[model samples]
Target: MADVWAKISAVLPGSVDQFPLQFSDTVESSVVEILKRCRQQLYSDSTGTNQTLYPQIVVDFSWEKLNTGTWRHIDKEWRRVYSYGCLFKAAALCHNSPSAEELLQAVRTCDMGLLMGAAILDDILQVIVRILQGEVRKSTKEDADESERTEVKRIKIQCPHAPAIKEELSVPRIKCPSLESFNTNYLLPLKPVILEGIIDHWPALSQRPWSIEYLRSVAGCRTVPVEVGSRYTDEEWSQTLLTFSEFIDRHILNKEDGVKGVGYLAQHQLFDQIPELKEDIRLPDYCCLGEGEEDDITVNAWFGPLGTVSPLHQDPQQNFLAQVVGSKYVRLYSPEDTDKLYPHQSQLLHNTSQVEVENPDTERFPEFSKAPYLECVLRPGEVLFIPVQHWHYIRSLELSFSVSFWWS
Candidate 1:
């Protein structure tokens, strides 16, 4: 425990110094004020009139009060609170006995800070987080990198039976075309195709397959945001944070006992938050074909149980949806079928279609029946390329883990 505290202490000086570098002078001053107030409130023993609210609540209010401002400003303020709160918590651990509650709080605070904090502080805070969680390195960083490069083993993965959907039109499948060929054939033409043999060498597919147990072991205690409800289209749908273990226990494993609501950890840059998991998969070289650099590509993780749905919607960037663990049934419609799809008129849902593809009511949306579409059951180790603005509907056929790379 002393060693753990020492590790955390070493990271604090660097993180504290880097916090004010990226923002304006005004933001830096505000951060100093917040840090001073938070430190005083947290270390205060008396519930006096001067400090009536708890430190955590005060920090949360500071974050929530800035909601109306630009998102950039709000994130800056939020990161200061979380990052300083994390530092204060780590300091407290040095003087007192470390409790599980305190350690968990420190871990969560650092996780929140990383969501929108200075890039310079990221690696420092990440190391602090692992130390507080008592996660030991299996090997030195150098050894781990060398092993990953040389010791990749491809083993057979037993995938569930592909869902039975009569395909009137199927997306074309290409077997690992060269990047130049891919750019000329698919990217230029704006067509959707599934490329096989692209992700065969990923450690996630071979050495460290993303089973429930494997995920639990590596990232069980890490904090992550998850969407709760049947689907995002539902009125009750909302997002919440859950530990990876809790998400699996309540949503994935508990589904057999007939769990009611769905919990999806969707559209999150989980790789940035958990670097250990990021090492298991390499970014596809094809992302270089985009105008932006590889770092500009938006990578998201989608993990959920069977039957979770991403209703028919389109994105603004070209996407590479890589199936890692289980199969998913994907149905796509070209932008030419936009009028036939009956997109929602509301500003919030303008990009989403109102009609559900599988069980569309022909009376209400008769044109949807005539909308020509392509469909496929995407399997593990396959990468599905979706062009910009192409409408896609996806449903998990089994417990699934998928990663998507979106780039312009």
Candidate 2:
């Protein structure tokens, strides 16, 4: 515990000192004062003022600057401020001897800042996040080990939606075709296909099969943004950060009875954050079919409980949706049928369809009734190729972990 605290305490001072220009004088003075008060609290009998309090307010003010229409072009200063607030907030909580959950929240704050803030702040906080994660893993090791040893049964895969759709409409399937064959038939024609046997060499499929326990042990303490609701297009949809174990307990294990909402860790650049998990997956050789360099490939993770939905949507890049655990029922419609699918008018949701694929209302969207589509049940060890701009909807059939690689 002493060593843990020492590692945690060493994170901020020297690292932050390296980037003198990163923090404005006024910001630095305020942080210095708060940190001074935090150190004072360490020896005081009673808990001193929480230096961690103002960072959230600072974060909020910095966040407000992103409300401008041209947010992509936002001044870098605000991003730096946001990162500064998050990093020191973690430091303050550490000095105050925060609870395990408090430490986790501090890590979450830093992750949010990293996801939305400046690149300069990344090197400063990376060590802090790792140390916090290590402390969390140490605290939860006993419970995690016990839970891992206990085998909990899972419900079988269920494809209760859209039962009447034609089996003939299923996406074309094949074993690992030659690169030339794949490019000639599928890539050039912009066709969707279910590819098999291509990822047999992946450690995720064999040595480190992505069980609930394996994932929990590997990344349970790490904070990730999770989508809460049936689907993001719904009115109640929102995103919040949670540790991987928390997400597994609430969403996967169904640990809390009577909880009605879904929580999904969807479309996150998880490989970039946790490189250990990255070692388990190999970038498909098929990505080389693209004109871009291998570094241009974008990998995202999707994990969720049964019945989580991704509404009918299209992406700009070529995609390989790889199923590592559980299964998914996927439905796809061509870009030629875009008008029939009735996409949302708002610029924000322009890529998403208003009509639900399985339970679409013909009275409201008559054209949707006539839209031709293809479908499949993607299983573990199978990868589904989705051509660019092809509208597709997906629903998990059980507790699932999937990786998607996107390339042009």
Candidate 3:
């Protein structure tokens, strides 16, 4: 029994510790619980039938058989390894059965030739940890990434998790329409519209080598907060503070692989951080048509490499998402489809839905299929109007830079 317990104790701790996300409890006993349920079903039955039902689980599993005809010890500790597949499935059939918990006690207290049990104990615990537990935690690393890493800490994630993006549609557009017509046709109706040839006059567009090199020259020394991840919804995502020059060096200049996992300078008040850079661009005239003061119109920067995503969500105020550096694909859905979008119930995330706009899960969020949406490939010198309460999704198609204004 000591050898069996020692083997079980050794592997269980390592498996729990190696799991990626922070677990509710480090010592997971789901497999042990499942095994107990399976045992009860086998022994306790109103009908005297010896038939036992088990779940059919498929896995690519293989392991060494211990204490056989020609067994050799791999190490000095004489640890025995036993591997089996569909073992968890048989146990998982007890997911919510009324079986009393006794297998764990039996396994823990079993002294049935400790040496023989030792051979199988370690592998059994490992299989439970690496196979069974791994199955349940496999999905939605993106969910963990978006809500906790980049989002405001006040937000909380609830069940029926956010939907993923699954469609791409075209958004409507106009070329420098009069402010009266713009308000009459789109703003008042709370609709999304794209404005063309809007930022053609900005000096930033004409700067010599206005690529990564020029950006480094201007705000290189400025310290700013950047979102470091391939997408905002990546599990490994987080926020970091870096000098603008250092950011360009580590995330841009030094980048060799691609734009999959790179740091992004986004939704930041770069205009306020480095006022000198603010001289390069001008705010659209459309903002003046609204009731807010010019000072009240908040301008924020969204800059990152290709593949960066701001998952499907809604904002509180009217927005003019102006593209200055590279192109971005913007998707817009009307507030009327709010129910289909599965907006978060929390007040902090209430303005945003849980659904991802790029790879949506129709089975989980079937109503999302019924929602109508508009999308566009926004290029330099163009601005996208996102009316207040409108849900939208944004993704960079290349290394991109843009400014957004939030106004009521």
Query: Can you give the TM-score per candidate against the true fold?
Result: 0.83, 0.83, 0.56
Q: What TM-score should be assigned to candidate 3?
A: 0.56
Ranking by TM-score: 2, 1, 3
Error of 2 at 350 (Å): 2.3
Where does candidate 3 stray beyond 4 Å?
1-169, 207-209, 256-260
- Score residue 92 of candidate 1 by CA lDDT: 55
For 11-59, candidate 3 gives per-residue lDDT tens digits of 3334423322221232135533433444343333333222223212111
| Top TM-score hit | 2
Candidate maximizing lDDT: 2
Which whole-number lDDT from 0 to 100 does residue 363 have in model 2?
A: 95
Show how many residue pairs clash in every candidate, following the order shown: 0, 0, 16
Candidate 2 has which clashing residue pairs, if any?
none
Off by over 4 Å in 1: 14-58, 66-78, 94-97, 116-123, 136-161, 165-168, 255-259
lDDT of 3: 0.58
Query: What's the C-alpha lDDT at position 15 in model 2?
Result: 40
How far is 108's C-alpha from truth in model 2 (Å)? 2.8
What's model 3's lDDT at 44? 39
| lDDT of model 3 at position 39 | 35
